[model samples]
Target: MSNLAARLRARRAHTRTRRAVSKAIDTATTTTMRDELITLAQTHGYQKSKPRV
Candidate 1:
């Protein structure tokens, strides 16, 4: 019983860590893409337009 409980705890911790790492990677990728897009728009003399309601 104790061994099973330990295994379960370890698995949960591993899952949590994996999820955090995945989220961090996703956030970094999004930020990098956004920066690249802004740079590209600036190079092409494009300004951000306001959204219409």
Candidate 2:
């Protein structure tokens, strides 16, 4: 009984951790996209050369 309970607790904790990571990844992706869009918007000008690495 104790072992089964421990396994269940561990599974639940793992699920919660995965969910948190997924949310964090989604947030980071959205922020990055927003920043890129803003940067692109700011670069709209009459004379501008493409940035080369």
Candidate 3:
């Protein structure tokens, strides 16, 4: 019984931690940041460049 209770408590804590991490990741990757990343990638040659006029 005690071991089962301990496992439940651990699972709750793990769930809370996973939720926080996922929320953080969602907030960190905004559209502007994504665009900046794309530009950065192009500069670094990781993304293909569009043909300039």
Candidate 4:
């Protein structure tokens, strides 16, 4: 019984870790995609260049 409980706890922890990793990857992907779109727009002159302050 104790062994089963330990296994369950370990499984839950592993699941949580996997979820955290997946979320991080998703966020990074979104950020990179946004950056790429912005770059594309700038390169194509769809977005105007900002003046230096």
Q: Report the lDDT of model 3 for residue 1.
A: 100
Better of 1 and 4 by lDDT: 1
Better of 1 and 2 by lDDT: 1
Give lDDT per model, in order: 0.61, 0.56, 0.61, 0.60
What TM-score do all the candidates reach, one by one?
0.53, 0.54, 0.52, 0.53
* lDDT (tens digit, per residue) of candidate 1 on 1-53: 99999999998876676555444444655778757656655565443444469
Model 3 segments more than 4 A misplaced: 29-53
Per-residue lDDT, model 3, residue 9, is 100
* Whole-model lDDT, model 3: 0.61
> Mind giving the per-residue lDDT tens digits that candidate 3 earns over 1-53?
99999999998876676555444434656888656655654564445333469
- What residue runs in model 2 are displaced by over 4 Å at the alpha carbon? 29-53
Alpha-carbon shift of residue 1 in model 1 (angstroms): 0.5
Model 4 Cα shift for residue 21 (angstroms): 0.1
Q: Per-residue CA lDDT of candidate 2, range 1-53, in tens?
A: 99999999998876676555444444655778746544554454212234469
The best candidate in terms of lDDT: 1
- Candidate 4: the clashing residue pairs are none
Per-residue error for 44 in candidate 1, Å, reads 41
Model 4 segments beyond 4 Å from truth? 29-53
